[model samples]
Target chain A: MPVHPGEIPKPNTAWIWKTFWIITAITALEFAIAFVMPSSTLRNSIFIILTIFKAFFIVAEFMHLKHETKGLIWTILIPMGLLIWLLVALITEGNAIHEAIF
Target chain B: MSTISPTTQAISDSALDKPRTGTWDGGNEPFNASYGKLMMWFFLLSDAFTFAAFLTTYGLIRHRYQPYTGTPEAFEFSTAYWPIPEKVFNAFPGLHGFDLPLAFVALMTMILIFSSVTMVLAVEAGQRFDKKDVQKWLLWTILFGVIFVSCQAWEWSHFITGTDEGTLMNDGTRFFGANLAVNQYGPVLFADLFFFITGFHGTHVFSGICLLIYCFIATTNGTFEKRGHYEMVEKIGLYWHFVDLVWVFVFTFFYLV
Candidate 1:
């Protein structure tokens, strides 16, 4: 398993290009929505969803999280899942508080 | 031979020196990842939470100030105290008379994402031990990062200087520029959150650029060549991608939402 100096490892370049295009396309869609779509609940939801989708590609492909072992991936993703839950709960609670006081 | 007790013999065999095997063995990386990579993932996970917390607070405060209900059209013209994101962020650089809402920030987002692509390409080149390609892509990524930061500076200056000599509120207060106290944009909290969230993300981008520069230098000096792997490039690539990932969320929460 020893490596020699200046030895170039063969890499799969196809995935890189595919991911690049996918990210670019998603971003283009986001920009389109921003301009054409009016500000509304549905628009906000779409923005959130698309943002998460873009995040997934960056993490999975660029960061190589998808190539990691399940244990490692879960170690990262599980906490993020909990964080999302926390976000939902807090925002809901914040709304309730706002309604009660104001 | 002197009487060697079992406990003494076991003590003499250092645990660190022992050959590890099975589930408890160090040989079995639970996630089949290197130590550095695993640590980076953990760090990013925590950082994500920090950003989520900030955005969540922003949502809470925004909802409190501007409670929109019923039809979207009604809410759009509801005359809420909170500022509309598009209205506040409508300015484009050097386009004084034109109102290009979100166009410039959108361009900034594209630049950051494109930089992320270059970072990935750099990592790919590193995998192949293509020093020249790695350096090339890294430089490109750095250049993009610099451009994004400069664009941000211009945006901030424009925001601070105030358009149309600031907004005159019904409360008989003339609001101008942004600070911890007041902002001409709208509610004070909006400007505060905007500065804090984007400022934090900007710091990350700055540091990511610094890391890329260091990697570029090391690559030129044949450091990774001697190591026989471009793991350093991959590690920095993870960080660079995380920065871009955070910005995606920031863009959604701050600008688009």
Candidate 2:
């Protein structure tokens, strides 16, 4: 194929492998924490935070979203704010329903 | 196509007459990404919301019950209480009868993470125009995806079959596994959400595998070479990464949490 100067992504193999290790380590940390820390609200919250951290890497490094323009990045992220609202609002309603049932 | 520079192809001839500062006015590649790639990103964002809706529903349903407050060792599966994830997904292949909570799903997570790594490598190779490496990485990615789906199938079967220590229900019959009707582990909704959520993600993985196969075959036959770019491979890579990303959330909410 002739080189016509297509958008060439930064072809850094080291970063890919580095990302793999970082993701794997976070998952390993998650699994270890599960065994030692008994199930509780705090433990579940920690799990959610770690999961978000891992998600950032998968999107940023693997999907190449990090290198995308900030405009593009915010374009995707800003709407997620509404999703957070959805989670909070519905979960609270669910708790109210639970109070009625029990 | 080969004669025209990528920049020329990206921006139309009329746009060249206009000022570069007026990005929105004409075709000055503002994001520096192709139209196809941008569409894929938008599509994935919509798909993310779909998954979010499913998960949010699960959270709402889960909160409707009083979560079992007992210690993990003393916990008993019942319809009256929310099930602990580790208590439900404990069995591992060839190592049954042992309580290795969260272990098997962890292995599944590792497999998915590795597959994402292979996907990015394929994208890298595509950018470099290394035909052989692109094909190699795509094949590896497809292989891992198949393995991941197979693991999910096995996990589903284990979930449906349940264990010998089935929970005794209110009626006196011992319910063993899970189905649309009842899960011995917890409320019927627990089993319902598990099937709906994980099954949906599994379908995405299955479709991703099919897309990868087509992408792989296209790469081998020199389709991309003639087209002068491997943007198709890059787009598919984005889809594959999104699948892996969804699994990360699924793993957190369904298994470890």
Candidate 3:
């Protein structure tokens, strides 16, 4: 059979193996931060950072966003980006409610 | 050796050479689905909002408890106040006699995380059209999801049972122990937030378990293999992973913080 000219190679088996390794490493790092770090702003910062990294790996590789089109990634990521704004607005509203009751 | 006709060859070549689209979708335009892959993206987007709302509410309640803020033990739930998380959620396994903080919840978190690995393997098997492997992975995934849900249920039972015999005061109304009544835990609001946040996330885990069961059934039936793609597994995997992701935040905001 004739081959396609521009088509990318089908992702190899190694992709799954590599994905596992990355996820394992990120999870280990998260455990370390949670267990070893003394409570502080620094520990919190590290925890959040590692969490974001773990999330990124799952989204990019296991979810195959890296293989997706720009339109798809944006469709997914833009809303997540908006969550920051959502958090601020919701938290502010929640605070107001707390004030009224308190 | 040039045995195939030119038009037939051209059609085959075109099928092979088609430029890949930019989207993560499976590119099956005829069915109006790029494949179920893109569904994961959208699902995650919606899920993120749900979790964000819960965590933000938690923050608001915690911030209100600021001044004269006491240590974990000081925030104990008497007939008058709400208990602190470090105090409430620190149940260790039997025989430890030591109060380890966030122990069971931490273990639950690991269970969900490991379940995610099994889900990915299921997806990988689906891609290869390996029915046996798919069945194995999906079974393991379902088992793990069920275990995670059971753990959550146990925690909820403990939370609801409270220290005393399930009677608590809240804003002058007598509420049951299962609820976040006033004086059951420092502020009436703490139990309110805890129930709402963890409850919603637990519901998600429940649904994820259902989804996993369905996936397992479908895998055993060889549906995806017949469809010639395993995108469904990947799509559901996104939902499973998102459930785990939300737990991370819940653990941070509810337990650790």
What is the C-alpha DockQ of each candidate? Answer: 0.56, 0.61, 0.26
Rank list by DockQ = 2, 1, 3
Error of 3 at B239 (Å): 1.5
lDDT of 3 by residue, A28-95 (tens): 66656655765566876777777777778777776667676777777778878787777667667766
What stretches of model 3 exceed 4 Å from their correct place?
A1-40, A89-102, B1-35, B67-84, B93-97, B164-178
Q: Which structure among the candidates has the greatest DockQ?
A: 2
Residue B189, candidate 2: alpha-carbon lDDT: 89
| Model 3 lDDT tens row, B1-257 | 23457887788678676546646653435224364555556667877887887787676656545322455444445533335456677655462445676778878977887788788878776666667778898899889988988888888876776543334454555444556544355566777887888889889989988888888888778676556566777778888878887886777667765
- Residues B198-233, candidate 1: write the lDDT tens digits: 999999999998998999999999888777678889
> Where does model 1 exceed 4 Å of error?
A1-12, B1-25, B67-80, B170-173
- TM-score (C-alpha) between model 3 and the true structure: 0.75
- All models: lDDT? 0.82, 0.89, 0.70
TM-score of 2: 0.91
